[model samples]
Target: MRIVVVGGGMAGTIFANNLARRLSSELKAGKARITMLSASDKHIYQPGWLYVALGRMTPDELEREEASLLEPEIAFFVDPVQSFRLGESHVVTRSGKVHEYDLLVIATGSRPVPEDVPGLKENSVHCYSAEDALKLHDRLQAFTGGRILVTVGLPHKCPMIPLEITFTMHDFIRDRGLIDKTEFYYTYPIGRAHSLENVATWASGEFAKLGVRQETFFNLKEVDGAKGCVRSEEGSEVKYDLLVAVPPHRGEAVIEENKLGPNGWIPTDRYSLHMQGDHGEKVIVLGDTTNLPISKAGSTAHFEAEVAAENAAAMVKTGRAARSYDGKVFCFIEAGKDRATYAMFTYQKPPEPRAPNAAMHAFKMAYNQLYWASVRGLM
Candidate 1:
C-alpha cells in the first residue's frame, strides 16, 4: 500500500511518523510505503513564534531539518504539491513529479491572511511569521507608552494565542515599567471574548484584573493608518499606538487552487477525519486543512493525526478503520511570563481551564523543547 502524506507541518509529520511505526513490518516486507512531501526543508515549531515576538525565543531555536524528524522508513521530499487530482488518486508537485497513492493524507495546514482585512497587513504587527515576530519584537522594544490595541480575526490558529499574547504583553510592558503609560484595548468579533464560553469567562476576568479594556462584537472592517485608528464592522473606531493582530486564517493555497473545498478548507468528517463526499474513503483530512469547527491548533492536529494514522494503518492491516476522532484539543495558556494554565477538551466536553500557576508554565516551557520528540511520534 502506498501512503502519500501531503504537507510536512505538525499534522503531516506526526501522521507520517506514526503511520510508519504502525506499518513497520509491512514496510520491511515492501507491502507498505510512507512518503511525505513538504515545501521547506526546515520543520518549524510555530508556537515558538509567539515567544519570539516577546524576545523569549529565537528563530534558530524553533527550526530543525525536516528529514531528521521523520522515521528512516518514511520517504521525505522537499517538493511541494502544486495540485491534487483526487479522482486520479495522485498529486502533481511543483517539480512536475506525480505521486500516486492508495491512501492520501492532506495536512497542508493554514495561512494567516491579514490582507483579507483592508489595510490590516500594512497597519498592524503580527507574529504569524518569523520576520513578523522579529518586527513585533523591535516594535515592542521601542514602544514607550500609549494605546496597544489587540484585534482578533476568526478561525485563527492557536485559539489561546490572542489571550496568551495579550497577557504576556501586559507582563512584558509591566517589566519594562511601562504598564502605567500603556493602555491595552482588545477586541473580538463575537459577542464574547472567546469562542468557548468557559474560556471567555475566565479570560474576561483575567483581562479585567490586568486592566485591559475589551470590545466584543467588533470585526475588522479596515484600518486608517494615517489616523492611527481601526474601524470595526459594527461602526466603531478605535485608535492605537501599536496594533497587534491575530489575523484570520485559511487553509494552504494549494488546497484552494485545487478547488478541494471553499477557502482552502477541505470538507472533512468530524469523527472519521476523512474527506467528505465520494473520495472520503481514500483521502483523510487532518489539521488546519479540515473544515472542522475546532481550534486550528497543534494539539488539534496532533489528535486528528493520531486518529487518521491509526485508521489508515488499520485499514491496511484489517481492511477496516479502527477509530474515530473525538475532537480532542489541548492548549497551554500563558497567563503571563511566569504563570500558565491549560485547557483540555473533547467533542463531548468543554474545557474548564484551571487557575494559572508556575508549574504549568514550566511544563509549557519544557514542551517547547520536547516538541521535537513529540513530532517524531515518541510521545
Candidate 2:
C-alpha cells in the first residue's frame, strides 16, 4: 500500500515518522510505502522562533535539517502541491509530477494570508513564517524607540504569539535602556486579549503590570504604510515605528481547490482525524488544515499525529472504528523578562490554572531540546 503525506510541517513529520516506525515490517516487505511532500527543505522549529525573536535563542537553534527527521526508507519530495484531485486519488505537484497513493494524509499546514486585509499585504511585516520572524528580529534590533504596534490579524495561528512579541519587546526595550523612549501597543480583533478567557484575564493583569497598552475589538481594516499607522474597523488609528503583524491564516490551496470545506479546511472526525468526504478509511488530515476547535499549535499537532497514526494503522489491519480526539491544547505564554505562563484545556472546559514562574520558562527551553531530539529520531 502506498501512503502519500502532504505538507511536511510538524504534524506531517510526526505522523509520517510514527506511521513508518510502526509499519516498518510492512514497508520492508514492499507492502507499504511512505512519502512526504513539502515546499521547503527547511523544517523550522516554529515554537522556538518566538524565543529567537526575543533574542533568547539564535536562529540556528530554531532550525533543523528536514532530511534528518525522516526514516531512511521514506521518500521526500520538496515541491509545492498545485492541487488535489480527490476523485482521481492523485496529487499534482507544481512541477507537474503526479503522485498516486492508496492512503493520503493531508498535513500541509496553513499560510499567512496577508492579502485578506487591504494594505496589509503590501505593508505590514508578518511574524508567522521563518522569514517573517527573521525580518521582525532584525527590525527589533535596530529599533531604538518610538511607538511599536503589534497587531493580530483575523484567524491567526498561535494566538499568543503576538502577545508574546509585545511583552518581549517591552522587556527588550527596557534592557536596551530605551524603555522611556518607547511606547508599546497591542491590538487584537477579538473582544478579549486572547481567545481563551482565562488567558485574557491573566494577560490583562500582566500587561497592566508591564505598562503595555491593550486595545480590543479593533479589527485590523488596513495598514497605512505610507503614514506608518494601522487603522481598525472602528476608524481608530495607531501609529508605530515598527509594526509586527500576524496575518490571517488559511488552509493549503490543494485542499481548497478540491472543495474540502467552505473555508478550504477539511472537516474531520476530531478524534479519528479521518477526512469526512472519504467513504473508506484511506484519507486522514491533521494540523492547522483541520477545522478542529482546539488552538492551532505545535503541541496540538503533535497530539493529533498520535491519534492519526494509531487510526491509520488500525484501519490497515482491521475495519474497526478509530478512536476519538479530545481537543486538548497546551500553550506557554511568554510574559517576557525570563518568565512565562502555562495553560492547558479541553474543548468543553476553560483554560486550566495558570502556572506562572521562571520554572515554566525553563520548561519551555527544555521542551525545544526534547522536540529536536525526538524529531531527529535520537530519543
Q: In candidate 1, how many Å is residue 118 off?
A: 0.5
Best by TM-score: 1
Which residue segments of model 1 deviate by more than 4 Å?
none
Top lDDT prediction, candidate number: 1
lDDT of each: 0.93, 0.80
**Where does candidate 2 have its weakest 10-residue lDDT segment?**
370-379
On the 0 to 100 scale, the lDDT of residue 147 in model 1 is: 100
Clashes of each: 0, 3
Which lDDT tens digits does candidate 2 get at residues 1-379? 7889998889898888888887788889998898888998888888876766766777788777788889887899898678777778888898999999888888888878898888887776766766676777787889888988888876767867877788877888898898888888888887888887877888889888878899998888888889988899988899988887888888877777777765667888776778886543667888898887778887788778877877776666675646777887778888787788877877666777564679988888788888976664334
TM-score of 2: 0.92
Q: How high is each candidate's TM-score?
A: 0.99, 0.92
